[model samples]
Target chain A: MREAKKQPGIAEVAAAAGVSVTTVSHVLSGRRPVSAATRALVETVIKELGYRPNPSARGLRTQRSESIALIVPDLTNPFYTLVAAGLQDVLMESGYLLSITDAAQPGRALPEVVRHVLARRVDGIVLASYGATDDDIASIAETGTKLVRLGSRFRADFGDVVRADDVGGMHDVVDHLLARGYRRIGLVNGEYDAQPSQMRLEGYTRALREAGRTADPDLIHFGTFSRAGGAAGARRLFDSAHPPDAIVGGNDLIAVGVMDAARERGLAIPRDVAITGYDDIEAASLVTPALTTVHNPAREIGRTCARMLLDRLAGKYDDVAREVVLAHRLVIRESS
Target chain B: MREAKKQPGIAEVAAAAGVSVTTVSHVLSGRRPVSAATRALVETVIKELGYRPNPSARGLRTQRSESIALIVPDLTNPFYTLVAAGLQDVLMESGYLLSITDAAQPGRALPEVVRHVLARRVDGIVLASYGATDDDIASIAETGTKLVRLGSRFRADFGDVVRADDVGGMHDVVDHLLARGYRRIGLVNGEYDAQPSQMRLEGYTRALREAGRTADPDLIHFGTFSRAGGAAGARRLFDSAHPPDAIVGGNDLIAVGVMDAARERGLAIPRDVAITGYDDIEAASLVTPALTTVHNPAREIGRTCARMLLDRLAGKYDDVAREVVLAHRLVIRESS
Candidate 1:
């Protein structure tokens, strides 16, 4: 390997800027405010010298990597990526590097993916799990890594939990469909075993019960949380003799698929069958006859997750795991 | 900061697995062949003990973080995310953590973002740059950091360059449109100064020249690579007294916007005006009248980039910078 030329250190930066090392430290950490002019001069000199505070060297002294790792089920999903975007916003502000790993991609088992990240020994972790077990959660905590779960399946005590109101959002959307005078509301949800799916199903049932009607088992179909999955479920519902007058998709991608299926079957939206979705992804608004869905604040949830993790790392919170639930609301659009 | 408990080490794994320390090391690194039965036993013990080869500890001894950083313009765009997905597939196989940062989001200036990541002292950097300068590229090399540029603006000697065949891809698409006998063609391209835009424009001109027709400056529009931007550009082209019979969107997102604009103006796709897009993003096929565009193979580009970086780090290749250009093809779909 070619030997790298000597890297400029804090002393070099201080010398170049004609300031004491303490002044340069203050400028870097922002723990103590320096004069604006001095700060600018120090920054300019640092840039001109191409000097960087080696994180590894700093980590050795502080016992902190100054980095956080996020493990998501899939990076391709818009919802997860939006959540990541939100997490990055806050973490970067605090000078923490965010490393994201997709658990589902490249066919790594959820447990193995978790273990792999744990080995990295990051300062903290924000796990947006899809199929992790209780054992997996316990293993992370055992390592004493600052743990925050996004849409967690375990109880609040397991870790700092940050999730949108999946159940309430689903309930409101179903209620809206009921108020629209659609009695037979067929629901196509995601994997039946997933936490979000179960929560959303509970909301669907609650809405039906409030209307003095029990949810028909035949009207609910569980599948993957994808457009193709939504289309497949829609097909099964439409092919039935007792097909409903309206359909509710578990998420925006599913709703888009339902729309596609409706078009394929020569069904005019809201004329032949009304549709509603959840998550309120970007495509939800862009699609024709804009989808009526629930506004799940994915980005806010991400920001909240990062803040919770940072609080623990900063010693602002105790060992007691906390739970935070962000509000979700109905987004009534043309589809319904 | 609460103190974390000491973690299980390789010795713990070795004791539990009934193997020597070297045997466990070989299993983790895969530097030598081990019997399948012993490998499985060692892995199970490692998982059971929750033993992780702490990267910080290993990094201290080996002077390697076993991590790579990817910097992109935006994470929300499907194209970049797909690239990240591809990069992750290879990096994970080599036991390297991938840290991705969006340079555009949260409104961080590009140079600042670059500087911020450089301080982390990662093993390598896969910079999918949008607006980085020659100085920015040079700074990375000066630090002895293994640098790979995805879609680099500079020549190959600056760093390893991995990109798709933007020029040839555009040329093929334009030629296809010409063969269909579309006399008047307008091009809605990305930012005027971007390398991709320049290369694509070159292809468009080359095709027009081959057809014995000089390109018209009035028919070209430059805007952001977004659906809204495409719509605005389309409006200008449509409002013209002599609007072109065909339009080429800079990317799939732009094409989708053009389609929306056409619908609002009561123009039928391919009937009233033919439309083509580049990139062939997921929405390209999902959109109504599926977009006829170029398949840029974003994931392949990402995989190739990771491979190139890894090869350099492994010392399999010399310090000389290399360039790899993957092929692009026209995906003829319903829109055209």
Candidate 2:
């Protein structure tokens, strides 16, 4: 059995790190910023000292690894970053070590995520994949391992899913646009193979129909879920003879792309045309006109996902799969 | 001792996932966007099938775990995000699993990082901390583990070090400020204990001396490396009886904070007050009036750090500590 070497005091760690006992304590206490080198040194010393917290507690849960893996699509997205923060908070509270990875990285095959989970022999997995499939899900559930899916092609029977009401959120954005007197609204969407985009598109059409508005096929464009892709789609829409009075991008990055194209064409937002985005990331408020966007409640989703997984791992929800649907809100800002 | 389970064929995984062979293969190949649920389903099945990559290769490296861990301070910062990407790219090429963690999480004691490093038994570590010390570096060095320090306190003997020429970069920014005829220059810096801030302060003083300008005590402020902190620092400078016409922010986040305060005060950038930031993060270009800042070569630093660690692990540089100093560039944008 791989047992912890021995108990080591904090003073020893500090001395090993070559910092004062106070500095070591501060670094471990999360009270202040220790120099980077000092922080690293302390990390090494802790490992060297085999400083395991509470052996009795660890011994009781020797059956449990106290580790989980979270596979997200991309780290560049602030929305995902928020999810990571929220997830970490919950997991840390549960005394679980969270291992985060990206599904979008090259060679990051969906199977590799499984391979890692198995290799690490983690207790659970949370997948906020850009895209995953039915068969892929069945594989995870078949093992009886605790798992939760965040905003993907999930059916209730597939597994426990924690997602935002993107469909309703999009409807709210369209309604807000209509109420603001923008009739010809446009939607530049990406990730056609993903659930968020499909749901968003549904809401867009549903809202337009409810308002008794005519739908112009020309107003809709498709592109990748990125700034450049959004810009490309917007450029196409703007170049068309009849453009939209307002455009709601699939996400914030896409919306930023539209804003980029607008700037290039000298088109003023809310004057020549208005623009909105999904996922009210940190950058949304910092942009020139401050993009009006829908709050996807990523942090809540993360919390819900982590909580649900921990519950299952603890045998709290052993009888059936669990599900949670987080709410979304349309935030009215300068752009719209 | 534990050994990898028997290798499962792709066909078995497909059947277990309840997907067609073609779909399972496609999911693994990354040729198309497989739905998220399916991706999850497939991952579960792969694990259920006790999947292993290959036997001979796995056996050959059974004694040599190809896992490397990276400990960064904050995930909210885009600079660290880029570093993660760069490090992942190289580590992946070397057939090593890169495990990333943040050293700044609340209750994330310094020991926990080391504990994780030891638990995973990673072959090496890369520490991208804001601040670190000599003792810390020496301790990590004594472990006989390959280590690389990214952007922190350093000495010629502090293991292997990879850092930006922050002092020179700061000098360039100061010279730029002087060239724009701003006599009363201020600096709102964060992470007083970190190398970046100290180097930037040094650069500020050096440029002023070269330009025959005396440094004023009233023109300097210190705060945490955060936007709110930056804003607070800037508010102080602005409230001062003799406010500077120009100011330099320790990093982009700080600069943005300063810009926020200036905006609230109705001070037009480059008109009423010129502001600049360090670490030209992604948001620097997206923010209103863009930003003038130093381009901290984060990705290059990450690559360098990872490469050096891998080299050490492979016995490429067994005797002496290696060092690499990445260059920094000043990017002039509208904010300045």
Candidate 3:
């Protein structure tokens, strides 16, 4: 493993630079000021010799892993992947490594997951769009791990929460559909228990009332937050005696499902049944008809979440219990 | 940080089980023979107390990090995310952690990335379709870092390689398209430099020749392995003086682009033009007029790649280089 010969140690660096060990340590650790010429000479030697500080040794001295864990519900979802990528971009810049875990799998106990991360002693954590029981949240908080919630707002008093404008974004999608002469619009929503699902539904109804359109409860269908769920709900809508002329999906996945349902039923998109989805995931544009949907700043949410966690770790815990709401927009395409 | 009381150690277990420290150590590490009754007693106490052997202590004694690095080209691609998830599933079971890195960013230095991973002293590495240059490979190999290539084959002496059945899968897709009575098929391909891209193109030409169909050079388009590239190629095909009746995308992203182009141009799928894609990613089904394409076990590929690296690390390197060729199948959907 040491084919290139052992890298020079700090002692060797100090000797080579003709400086005392104490002075070299002060210059390298930035503990005290050193002469400009001496500092430059030491830095040059360090760089030229390719000296890398041992992580284990530094970890022992700093009592920090210089790493963080990103816990998400699922990675198969493009939205989560994009968010994770965003988090990596910011965290990697600060010389911090990211360890990712998917909490969606069964049989892998959450407590064990927490313990494993704790054993690593990461400086912080970024939880992305995943639900945890109240007890779980309390346990994590009590463990003294700096936590930041992304997309899912929960236990406001426990940690920093970063989210997108889901309610407003949904309203934009619904209003756009109405403005496009789409009447009798059907809604394929997510699980009613989830916060995003309820908020989106509220936005949908608000937009309908503003348009002087009576909200039809029968036209609303709730299912899992997945493509299959959207397909199932869309099928039910199409089988109804009075099928809707257009469908509004809770997110891009559901909208994609709505598209699938229309195809299976031999319905022409935007002609026989216009469809709209939210989140504006990468798939939204790739799908046929390029789903007209709302663009949620997933990557930005991740960056903000990481920065919030970093701030907390830096002892800025009293920075108020604020919610960082990033901008979202409605991207009009062919679907609607 | 150690606020909780320290858990009982091996000495306490020996005291409780009425055994010597050596006997307990033998039973725990399976290093030496111990009476069955004594072994059972020690095991019971170990399980009852939920005692975990200290990984750091064990690592110190074994001279290993008990960790590995997984280098992928991109994580925004759902395919790679699934692969990462799969690799994590297997590695986590063995008490090994994964460090994931995305190498697709422009101006990203590979040597620095390799050095960073090596600095962490990861026990092995899994390079996923990264197209690593010879120098990069040589540098990592020189460090004695066990390496495995996923979704790409390397020189026989390079290391373990896991590749999908690209040629066979492409042939199946092209045959299905030709059987649908479509001629003048356009090939939307990925970077021509990639091995899979070249193999897939060969399959397409072979199928056309066997069907007594002339391959039109003008119908071939090459782009990056992304949905936008696919869409761009589809647009060019549509603008051509004579547009093809069908398009075969090298992968799912390109196929998605083709769908978007058709929708933008108001071309009815299958009626005006039929399209088929490869990979059959999760998006393939959710999109409107679900894509007809080939399915590659991306997650399985990742899992297999990790396993091979583990085997290599366990001193199982042999003269007969092991190669795992996973199966691929064509999935028919509404698009065709």
Candidate 4:
């Protein structure tokens, strides 16, 4: 029994049950009809022998890879991972697997990624952070593959988009900073060409205009959406002849960099130069003085995106040109 | 022409070529032979239609699912995402799709997860940051699936294991802290049974003993491997009458919590209370008083695990069972 158990294969089960491999597969999957006597014998043999069909073999008939793709702008950032967790949760429940791709590499490889996902024939695709160009988005829309964009907004006439209210969220942060008596506010922005960066910069400028404060071009520094970029930006801000009293970074990593820059210059947070960040990642709460930042709903965005894609795949939504904007919150900690 | 280019279906390609769907499929996939003239005509029509095979349709083949599974403890941690990125880098090159699952939820649902992965028939499985019990591991091994463990060392009669030098790495951290003149050191550990936690604890004790210092039971606290747990453990350490002058956490998240605890108590790091952490995640560098921690080779570990699994699948190294232990480094920062 032990020897037989050690080498339990489909052939052993088929032979034991007096059936062929095809017959066994037909009985197991019920893709075709089989005699009750033969079915019962196969079932008994399968149960007794602990016979399991190779997954690779069974996958051939379903025409469903049962997998999806998750493309994020960066993996080093904790925010995307949290979003990934949420997406994985929902997709796993529906028996779909997720493949993750980083979009922040050189050239931002979205086109190649799209081709790979298509080649693998994934059930759907989730764009976690990359903003799709018109051409790419249009192609995806035409391909009839379900797509959900996370933390990004696009004009493409395809797929549902899940985004946080960056404008409103930034407004809250600016208002709170003002209420806290931070007058000379500086903005550490990301690349101006990116949609989120543009929206955030606009929000900053709009808030300053509303508050009767001139938006100083010198106060704004543009860099990559990263901690080093934030650090460098902070250095530039500090080097300026007229340093702002408070700095608002494009995202939390930049905020952390600004904090590092402040500490390097012997400046204290909130006491000497207040700082704030966006995307309220896990690091926001873990950083010293904790970080006063805008809470972008990363996980919620991911879950909503996955659910939206699943809905689209299941024909729950007929219109592909739908947008779902999620809400973001402003969390004030010691930095402000 | 533009409208025709917008929708490329197999039927359109077949109709354009005046061939049956089966003939077109056979011609395109090379499953069976067709006349040269018909094949050439079908190819031209396929190109004209811009027809791409639906991955869902191709997935129905039994021999190759072209999908893989990545199981991790949590994605909220940046380390796992980094590892995921490395795994994706390799798997993507081979045209395999990936699905990720978080096993941190209560009860972990390992059996269900196994069944799901089996049903999908992933070409292989990668286990990261999580470990399976003997029975569960044995069951998976019995199924003849190619399995690889990342950042974990477990020997089963079947499957491969990959791990980092946890004991040696912890010793490096402890020695560094000791060299920095930190005595009366405390240890903040994860759940007692976790593999890394147990190994780290052993190294901590061994280091203290080697330094001719008696181990203080009161200085050790076990908590969840999270920031909250670290915070709680730090509070316990400080609230005690004999608060240690230094603290070592099992991981970076716990160390971040300890840093918070020190700030709340007004203890100056590296002066009043030096702290060290393990797993040099991004936050370890970004946090205030940048964390001095052990740098586990996360990406290397992930890449090595993938290679090991691929080698097993390819029938390489059949005669010998082997283990690969990667090296780790201690990154010194402001915290200690």
Candidate 5:
């Protein structure tokens, strides 16, 4: 193997071609569509820079296991499983097998899981981490292992990020509820420290302000992402001297719990307390007075992560971290 | 490495020790509890029979990538995910990372998925196969890889079987519904070829016979396991000349769809019509009038599969295939 420091890299080739590194990558990998003229220029630059695309690296790639590992916080959560489904569908088509492991299991934290996956020498890794530190990610990259971060737990600069627009999704949710003439709306969010929860809170506040209603801190309650958490938040709001006319769950599971709490108190859904949730999980529609919620594109996000990781493995680009934000939609059902 | 043809294996040692192969295995692995006296006798017999456990085999075991792969029909289903969760919890405690793959994805048939998993040389495989054939089982076994068959898709003689009691569970559901004085019960099952569907249908028939009522052919409907299938089946039963007084779903998803069908017809649950379902998944309780369903121990079944597979990998037993059937119970909620 030639010394990497002396060998010209893809960056040099891109610079000589006067095109983005990504364009140069696309020209090499042929993974994405590129203009014919741009492709020709990039091919010429590659030969001029003596950027021999690492013959030894190509040899190693041939011996590659052609398997990808996905580490998720909760395997039982439908959102994560749906993501796994999408990821598997795409990877399977390209002759790559996807191995999904869980991070929430005892003694199998994110760092520990990463070590085991790295030890297996998978071609790449997709991590849906909530508390992964910089060191955790750096360790994987340092090994020349392609990596893609799922969700908004880390900044875009950290690595390739594939996630839904949490802020915009939540903003749409609140605006929809307010438009229905529901005053004193309460938000029951997941743990406050989690980036998704924080972003959702920001969306709720912005929507409230845009509607000429001052955001009430008293109406905000944060808890775990389970039904128990949502129920606890709903109870707190219900017990307050001034309960909100509507309650919004951070996710479907929490929203289901809020409904449970309301029912326990003999409160009829929609008639007594309008309810809404995020992540239009099957349970949302299964519940009576089916929940009005945001349809977070979890499956699409998973597919995007697989594509991004595949691109990296194909030697597409080694530039700064890239990000892909999927779209979200409001699914209005009977609850509102 | 010594030639295996000239060496005494675990079976020979067990025969000379006058003990069961499993007992000798237990003494060797120390994974399960065994008496000290039995352990001493087994060790002594090993020395007398010149039965040297292959050192090369031991070295290979040491070099094994401590990871297991799980292949399920559908990754998006909560039942499989819950099982994966249970499997992960037990495997993690033993320092084993589990990689889950889906067989239902396009271009990723069961055999193809198995080939990829085998190519990666996983320590063991846990397959929740629906249509796997004898060739599939023989191929995995021929590789000298540890295997555990999840679900009732295959017979116990084929390999290690870990599954819930589908027949007994469905029987209990029927008995409960009968006790509630609901006559003219119709069953909507999954595909006719599936072992679970067959077993469940048998249970439903046996219950009807014991109650001195014959199962009407028109009352039996077969469809896919999704919500649309359930709803379609329910609609058929509803439009029949003699609509069933109650409907039973093969699984919870189908039951939710049955609920949808009833709602579309403006029928009040348990009043104008009664409903029941199998697999008391999260959606069972989340749905209105909660679901009267069988509580399938999917997670426990998953845990059992992991333990069984680990025992095999530990060289505990290589005799005839083993089987473990977990228990199931009927959960009578309001929907009944």
Candidate 6:
């Protein structure tokens, strides 16, 4: 390791500027009145020295944490984490730092989690998790901070929302499968009550109905939104007397799981059990037979959420909650 | 969506608690002295109403952002994003919000970024980007903020560093390939100047020498740490007059690219050409032949970085810098 040079201290910055330390502190923090010439001098010295105004001392003057909290289910998924990256891209530039937390685990109610972050007096909270309860929504409403929701499909809605048109995306997936001459198509979906789950299920049934085929409730299996969930759903379909020739996973992770199960059965993908999925994650293309799936702009959703929160922070929209539904498309690959 | 109720205002809390609004604000921000009884009363009402004191108003009293910035190249890669998530996990519980910034794009100097974020008055910065320049190191040294460098491998390092054992891990990969009867093994490495690339190259050549095989300089390909670089390297290898039967990618994305290139050439993985990768990301298992690679604990690295920064913030060790080297394991899978 290279030896680190000692950085200039606040006292050195004050001394270089030919001002009292208090004057320099006040000039940096904007807590007290100071002459414009003196302020400029202090700032120039700070710049030359690369001095960082003591954050704690400045916080007393600003009365703001200048931080935002992003609550997601987890970061294990590339999709969720990428969204976070996107949000950071926007917020970091705006001088507002974003902190992320996982609320997907079974314990720790959403309200409690939000309360814990709010206790820090963060400037904003972006609720990007799934199935936020009514109480959770109410708790978030208690704070005046800007709030933006990702996948806001719950019946009791609050906050600016960035949602995906998964319904249309799923319809396209089913249509593509139908066009490929695959009959007995099955669906691997998330929880029944989740907003995305219901919308996707509706699209799946609607696609079958539009093709002059009756929807088969038996063909639809609900599980958690995870790889294990998809694997279990595929197993249920395969073990049944009437196994579907094609399966559409709610997300890429689930589709990967389904593919794993099929491989264990020595089944050739696309040749035997054609699989499709939503959320065209990076793995969707890397997998053996690249998964045929719907491409949801997850990062874009994150960016939109951050922008909406920033707009709220800026009062650009003035109490008018904006609902943004991002676009999606069907991505064809080797799997289908 | 259910209609949201009107949340109680600060004035309501003050009225209910029988305290003045200034007292309530002071109690929340800790800016001014408040009587113990009055502070407790104000707190109870604030809890009952679930009120979040306006961040800006509170900032005047506290004078701190209470946030940290994490500078990473990009989160599109699961490896980088997972590390950010790990840091968030540790920082959130300590009442500190973590902000993330991307330092990976070409042309934008790293020091400029560190300075820009420093101007935001963030409490600290956890820099997780690779290949920091001397200017970047010097710029970081100019700030009083606590800074932790992730993946820093330079012999002369400044600041706390968290690194993985990629060198030993690469040696194991070469040995594994040699044991499998692959004599002509090629290495698709990253930037020659970077620490991991140099270390991995050393391990690869050392393993061949120890196994009584002459190391071939012609078989080494240096490229960027990306999938495209790997694909290009693979093409060069195949087009060579003497092509190796096995290739070791510096990282997983590179290996994935190699697989892509091989497939385009009508080559069957493991049968025609075996490929290995480092950094056993989630994609490693999801790929066609499942990439055989080194398992670097990315999340653990993030956690350790965060812990080190927190310890510094708490002054636990009284100004001594700590260097943490994380362990890596060889994951044997179908690719080899």
What is the Cα-based lDDT of residue B314 in candidate 3?
72
Clashes of each: 0, 31, 0, 11, 0, 16
Candidate 1 per-residue lDDT over residues B95-167, each given as its tens digit? 8888988887746767777777777778899988667787887767777788888765547557788888888
lDDT scores in order = 0.85, 0.78, 0.79, 0.79, 0.81, 0.80
Model 3, position A157: C-alpha lDDT score:
62
For candidate 3, give the docking quality class from DockQ: acceptable
* Best of the two (1, 6) by TM-score: 1
Q: In candidate 2, which residue ranges exceed 4 Å CA deviation? A: A1-66, A93-95, A107-120, A134-146, B1-66, B103-105, B109-121, B131-146, B156-158
- Candidate 1: the clashing residue pairs are none
Count clashing pairs, candidate 1: 0
Cα lDDT tens digits, model 2, A211-270, are 998678898987788899999999999988888888999999999999999999999998
Number of the top candidate by TM-score? 1
Off by over 4 Å in 4: A1-63, A106-108, A154-156, B1-62, B129-131, B156-158, B239-241
lDDT of 6 by residue, A1-336 (tens): 333445566899988988889998788668899999999888888888767655444444655556788887766777887787778767767767667777754444466578778777666788876767877776667556667888766332476778999889899999999999999999999877777888898899999999999777778999977888999999998888888999999889989989988987888999998999889998898887889999988888888888878777776876667788889988999998
User: Residue-wise lDDT of candidate 4 within A177-284, one digit each (tens)?
Assistant: 888898888988876666678778878888888998878898998887888899999999999999989999999988988998999999988998999999998888
In terms of lDDT, the poorest run of 10 residues in model 6 chain B is B55-64
Q: Per-residue lDDT of B16-76 in model 2, one digit per residue for the tens?
A: 8889877876776578889999998998887676664432233233434466777777777
Clashes of 6: 16
Give lDDT tens digits, candidate 5, residues B1-336: 011133477889998888998998789779898899999999999878746443224324454546788998888778989889888778876866687888886677999888777655567899887777878877677656778887665454567888788888989989988898899999998877777888889989999999999999999999988899999999999999899989989999888889999999999998888899998888888888999999999888888889988887777875667778789999999998
Report how far off residue B106 is in candidate 3 (Å). 3.6
DockQ preference between candidates 2 and 6, better one: 6
The C-alpha TM-scores of every prediction are 0.90, 0.80, 0.85, 0.85, 0.80, 0.86
Q: What is the Cα-based lDDT of residue B320 in candidate 5?
A: 63
DockQ, candidate no. 4: 0.36
DockQ of 3: 0.32
Give the interface-residue alpha carbon RMSD of model 4.
Answer: 5.4
lDDT of 1 by residue, A1-336 (tens): 244777898999999999998999899889998999999999999989877776766676677888899988878888888998899888887888899888776467678777777777788999887687878877787777888888755475577888888888889988898888998999998888788889899899999999999988888999988899999999999998898889999888888889889989999988889999998877777777888999889889989998998898888867777889899988999999
Better of 1 and 5 by lDDT: 1
Instruction: Name the candidate, 3 or 6, with the larger DockQ value.
Output: 6
Model 5 chain A: ten consecutive residues of lowest lDDT:
A52-61
